[model samples]
Target: MVTNGTYERGDLFDPNCGTRLILDRIGDKWTALAVLRLQHGPLRFTELRDGIGSVAPKVLTQTLRRLERDGLLTREVFAEVPPRVVYDLTPMGRSLIGPLTAVSDWAEEHINAITTAQGQYDAGS
Candidate 1:
């Protein structure tokens, strides 16, 4: 726990803290993609799978479950002739969009430079 004049925050850097667990969730590539896809609006399971192409169904399911467990997203199930499920971001998840967008923008902006550096490192190795 963090103690200050008037504010308190979780100690993210602590080895045993939940912060690292949280990071493990959002730091995942699939999680990032899923979050971004849901930013536009809610989508069904198939829609999410199709949008996040090449992801195994099981992996996607696990990712969705993890996000929901963390309270980052909501899963709604509807009863019909055929069962239907949809996923959407929660307020906490929506709050992440801007930061993730900034990260995406930065990656796009620096991709070329990063690739060049990778090439140089690979050549030297």
Candidate 2:
């Protein structure tokens, strides 16, 4: 679906397209958590890790790198005794907060039903 070195209208629906790549990045649980945390304000690496609890340092590093590479967030390093680094969402990433919040709301509303269905399916199995 590339006409002039850009994806056309239906490129997102194509299986062998870049859309899946970007989706895989943002669709990740860790990525979602990181985005949610950064929505409030910029935070240091440790702050992000602590806020998004249970994530390993290495995994969080990978998620942050991917988000930075995708132009969703910016990473700034400060010259200090410990060389502090902070992460903040760019305009594009900020724009995603509304949609992500809607998804979060939907999940919160449906979680009970989803768990019930899962329990039923497990029992039936």
Candidate 3:
């Protein structure tokens, strides 16, 4: 028998399914920035931090680890005295760039509309 908790086919809205898990992983402020940075090929840990701008090192490390664990990025460590660590987007992460860009453009285009709608909502309330 099929379990109710299972996603089966073509069911992405299931709360505990892989799709939801991925959504939870990537739906964060830092994850978006991290993905954007990795879109320009791979970068060392320090470079990622700089590219993202002002994110604390600890937060950046945690974000990268979460993304890596979720298969959106690959973290590589070079064998050396201090060890060089780099992050690169996986195919999954690269696939997100175009979509994210469209989302960004949409937000830019609709800022006025959204603000107006919010104002209307507040006035109605």
Candidate 4:
């Protein structure tokens, strides 16, 4: 339920909860990178693609479309000789940055340990 624009938190543990869908969206690698790339400001398609490195054009387009559909970002098109489109984060999207940054920090801190564990597990298998 929502009251005056604030949502009553959903039970994420519930099997039928919509929160899991959101979790899936935010948990994607491309989503994370795209959000991080747009943190500074909006960018055109090519600019975002370049900033995100090797993601294929189709993959990035799909990711951006998903983000737009989820209301996490906005896509604007401008009419010109060649046309222009820009992607910018919404307020809700900007809110994700801090949490994502924390997760990123945790990953950076534990990556070596994680890789070591993976190597050990692979060797045992």
Candidate 5:
């Protein structure tokens, strides 16, 4: 439903809704981390890899490609001696920071309780 080029709100509860795919992308651990890492500014491939911890080079490349395809981020290549490339978040991607931050904070706040619950459940099994 488009009214004068503006799309109406999507119904996420609908199985066919594309919003679920967007949700899945944002819910991904790598995606969330990558987005958070770019919150400060752009970073090079190696920098992103190091900042993201244990992500493999191949995996990171794929993730970056997917993010680029989804319009969440941009990858720019510079014509340098060694050919430098940088990744930066787009406006849409920056919008995710607040929501991701909230989720991250909630996880940090409840991790101990979650661990305790998991342990209790395991012991009872």
Candidate 6:
């Protein structure tokens, strides 16, 4: 498809492949946070921005776009005075429950120890 006289490869480990494309979508700074924010229920754009703490508006918009493009979140636009928009997880996104829950529980259980380790590492550095 190019001057290199080569076609695209489908292998994920190829470094220039499409298989890791999914990771590129959801493995960023804000996609997971957006998903976690939407887990409770649907939220407006402003609410989502506030829920995720200090993320900038531009970053949040980009994150939401990536999630929507990947079919993980649904965005609804309402016809109203201010044209409200809401974000919610698709069923596919909800399917992430088990893994997220497991990770959350594990984090809760060992947070103290993790904090101690971080403190030690910080002191060393």
Give each model's whole-structure lDDT.
Answer: 0.91, 0.91, 0.85, 0.93, 0.93, 0.82
Q: What TM-score does structure 3 among the candidates reach? A: 0.76
Clashes of 3: 0
> Taking the tens digit of each residue's C-alpha lDDT, what string does model 3 give over 13-107?
76545666666666677898889888989999999999889999999999999888878899898999899887899999899888777877888
Better of 1 and 3 by lDDT: 1
Per-residue accuracy of model 1 over 39-60 as CA lDDT, tens digit each: 9999999999999899999999
Which residue pairs in candidate 6 collide? none
Cα RMSD to the true fold for all candidates: 3.4, 1.3, 3.4, 2.5, 2.1, 4.5
Q: What's the alpha carbon RMSD for model 3?
A: 3.4
lDDT by residue for model 4 (35-96), tens: 99999999999999999999999999999999999899999999986999999999999999
**Ten-residue region with minimum lDDT total, candidate 1:** 1-10
Comparing 1 and 2 on lDDT, the stronger one: 2
Distance from true position, residue 3, model 1, in Å?
A: 13
Q: Which lDDT value does model 5 have at 31?
A: 94
lDDT of 5 by residue, 1-125 (tens): 34686556678797766667788889989999999999999999999999999998999899899999999999999999899999999999999999999999999999999999999999999
lDDT digits (tens) for residues 10-124 of candidate 2: 6677788767777888789999999999999999999999999999999999999999998999999999988989999999999889988998999999999999999999999
* TM-score (all chains, Cα) for each model: 0.89, 0.93, 0.76, 0.88, 0.91, 0.76
Q: How big is the RMSD of model 4?
A: 2.5
Model 5 residue 13 CA deviation in Å: 2.7
39 Cα displacement, candidate 6 (Å) = 1.6
- Candidates ranked by lDDT, best first? 4, 5, 2, 1, 3, 6
Whichever of 2 and 5 has more lDDT, that candidate is: 5
